[model samples]
Target: MTQENFNEGLLGFLDASPTPFHATQNMAGMFENAGFIKLYEEQRWELEPGKKYYLTRNDSSIIAFTYSGEKNYVMVGAHTDSPNLKVKPNPVIKEHGAVKFGVEPYGGLLLNTWFDRDFSLAGRVSYLDSNNIIKDALIDVKKPIAIIPSLAIHLDDKANQERSINAQSDILPILSTSDDFHFEQFLKDQLKISGVDEVKELYANDLNFYDVQNASFVGLNDDFIASARIDNLISCYVGILSICSIDESKPMLFIANDHEEVGSSSTSGAGGSFLENTLHRVFDDYEEFVQMIRSSIMISADNAHAIHPNYPSKHDANHAPHINKGSVIKINASQRYASNSKTVSRFMNIASSIGEPFQTFVTRSDMGCGSTIGPITATRLGIETLDIGVPTFAMHSIRELCGSKDAYSLYKIILSFNDS
Candidate 1:
């Protein structure tokens, strides 16, 4: 796809993926359209060289790979999940005659940012099928259905100075104030319209509320993209789309894990045995599996914080990365990030060869750091991994921002790495 097409496609992806389940499902559609063969974990072996395949776990984590018989496998790692407020099961809490739903912060969320914004509730819900087996359906209200309104300044004396959000009370989204309210019935209705006419018996649900605003170009020259979930979905789309856009001679992979924002300990996360088990199941032969892994290298792409103009001192000045500049090779001395000099140099070479500019970002020495799936994947697979991403701002806010061109650049870099 052309750069213009890439820009539009990325925005479309961001809009379609409100939650990790939706993100994985949307990506699966892309893979299917590109003729990628879907493999089942419970099914037997049918491996072939020069072929492309994809898989999903829990319908949230997904991996797509291609075989080209090359010595070194090029794998791109990313996350489908982002920081957001997730709904608790049976989460209703009626307070002062208002109906609100209970929610717990899903990750390292910036609480204040979500105080006042339209939210569209969306996620997966499990229901008993006609065959008595539980089936899952992704549901979205699409339009704004709820909101977390902030307290009035007149009511709280220190609202501007020291007000703190009470996750239990302050962050509960107002679902409705109608006399009759039933969340379970809402889920049942959602599942019925989710393309399954035979959805019966709402068994359970795993849902999250997201900002209703769609992604769009911002800035006078349209220099930036303002949207939610760009923190990692941008990386996820870049990797998945680039792989789909190219044909590799050697084995290459793209794995977007869920729960990365929450420490990745879930069954479908990088910290779990998903990657190791998949490699073993696919390669079967220990020698071949070892060979594939011995030379394999993974590049973990997640959005890096751009130097915030209001808090520029928080970043390392020398290594501050800006949006539209290029992908930033993120490093942390404490290993919060997984990038090492060797991996950095290799990525630098790849970027330089493709005329794709690259930058570096290091956390301020005095400040603690955040992490991505890079370290987890590197440690889990024992593969050389590097953490990188396009520079972004307001990373965990209700709405995030990034350069319009950076995503395209990241895609080009991933394609170059895949080709190499």
Candidate 2:
């Protein structure tokens, strides 16, 4: 696909996926539309060569693969989850003539960016049906329903210099001014609007508030794209497009797991047995599974921090990645990123063969480094892996930015990698 078309599709995916559940559902739909058969974990598997299959765990993590009877496979890994504010179980709070919702920060997000923005709720909700059967449904309150307004500067004249956010008291999102507001009734209303009409008890929900603004092109020449959850969702989008557009006859797989933002320890996360268990199921022979893993390579795609012109000192001058330069190869001496000499050479060769420029990132020696699912997956599966990403700015902010050309560039490299 053309770069323009690819970016348009990416924008759509970003706007549609406000939570991990929604991202997984949207990606599963893409695979299904490309003739991939959906598999359930509870079902017995009947292996068939030259067919494609996709499966989900916890409705928030997804894995899609093509079976070609090959011992080795090409793999891509990404995370569907991003940093946001999660709603608590007993979220309702009435104070000072306004009804607000208690929220907890989901990850290491920029708390300041979340203030004074229009917000909406989206996630998975479980409830009993009319027949008393438990069922889960996805919900997206598309419109702006809440906001966390910053305290006026007049009240705290030192706000610009001395301001600090108290996560408990400073970030409660105002839902409504009316004291009669009922959180459960409001959720039921949203469920009905989302087509879940069976009137029954609400068992539970895993909801997160997201920026209501849609993804859009920015910059004087529209060279940049801006949106919430761009840190890893952009990588997920690139992986989806790359895997779907490649030759499916090859033994290739693309997996987008949930809970990566929170250390990836959940059952459906990279630290869990989801990917390993799935591989074992696909290759029943233990020896063959080992062989496959040993011979295969995985590219873990996550967003890397680009050198900010205003804060250039934050990055190492020699290892700073620039916007639109290319996909970044993230490296860390502490193994925070999984990139190694062998994997780096393999990735660089693919990009070079495709005539695409690539960059490398290394944090300053005095600074600590953040991580992705790369090292975790590599350690878990004992697979050769590399960490790479599109150079990004304002990562983990409510609205992040990235060059419009970077995602398509990574997509091209991944296509070449799959063929190699």
Candidate 3:
């Protein structure tokens, strides 16, 4: 796909997916459209060579793969979850004449950017049906419903110089001013509007408030794309598109795991048994599974920190990556990232073969480095792994920025890697 089309698809994916559930749902749709047979973990599978299959866990994480007779596979990994504020179980709070939502921060987020933005809610909801059966449905309150208004600077003159955010009290989003607002009724109305009928009772919901602004191209020349959840979702989109566009007979797999931002310890996370269990299920024999894993490699695609012009000192001068340069290879001597000389050389060779420019990133010596699912996946499965991503700015913020050309560049390199 052309860079324009690739970025267009990325924008659509970002805007449609406000939460992990929605992201997984959209990815599943893409897989289905590409003729991938959906598999349920509970069902028996008949293995067929050169067939495409996919499955999901907890409706939040997804794994799609092409089944081939070859033992070795090319794999791409990304996370579906991003940092945001999630609604509490009992979210409704009426105080001082306005009803607000009780929200808690999820993952490491730029808390200040969340204030004074148009906000909406989207997530998975579970409820009892009219037939007395429990079912789950996804909901997206597309319009603006709530906002976290910042306190006026005039009221607190010190706000600009010194201000602290209290997660509990400072970030609650005002929903409505009327005392008649009921959270349960509001959910029921949304479900009905979403065409989910026969809702008997709302048992539970996992909802998050998101910025209502749509993802779009920024700058006069459209050199950048601005969107929420771009940190990892862009990688997820690249993986899915690359997998779908490749020759189906090629042995490849793509996984978008959930809960990476908050440490991937859950059942659907990279730290868990999801990928390993799936591989075992596919290979069946212990010997073949080990052989396949040993022969294969995984590319962990997460956003890399781009050097900010305002604070270039934050990055290592020699290893700093700039936006629009190309894809970045992230390395850490302490193994915070999984990239080693072997994997790094392999990736560099692939990019060079395709005539693609690439950059490297290493955190400053005085700064502590952050990590991705690369090390976790490498340790879990004993597979050769490398960490790479598009250089990004404002990572973990409500809205992040990345070069319009970077995503497509990485996508090309990933396709070439799989082909190699």
Q: What's the TM-score of every candidate structure?
A: 0.97, 0.99, 0.99
In model 2, which runs have C-alpha deviations exceeding 4 angstroms? Answer: none
Q: Which model, 1 or 3, shows the larger lDDT?
A: 3
For candidate 1, write residues 242-343 as lDDT tens digits: 788777465678899999988999999989988888877777788888887878889999889899889998898999998899989999988899999999
Residue-wise C-alpha lDDT for candidate 2, range 227-276, written one tens digit per residue: 99998999999888877887767888999999998999999999999999
Write model 3 residue lDDT over 23-60, tens digit each, in one string.
Answer: 99999999999999999988899979878999999999
**lDDT score for residue 41 of model 2:** 91
lDDT ranking from best candidate downward: 3, 2, 1
User: Candidate 3: misplaced stretches above 4 Å?
Assistant: none
What's model 1's TM-score?
0.97
lDDT of 1 at 112: 94
Give RMSD to native, each candidate.
1.3, 0.8, 0.8
Q: What TM-score number comes out for model 3?
A: 0.99
lDDT: worst 10-residue window of model 2 = 241-250
Clashing residue pairs found in predicted model 3:
none
* lDDT (C-alpha) at residue 201 in model 1: 83
For model 1, what is the alpha-carbon lDDT of residue 275?
84
Highest-scoring model, lDDT: 3
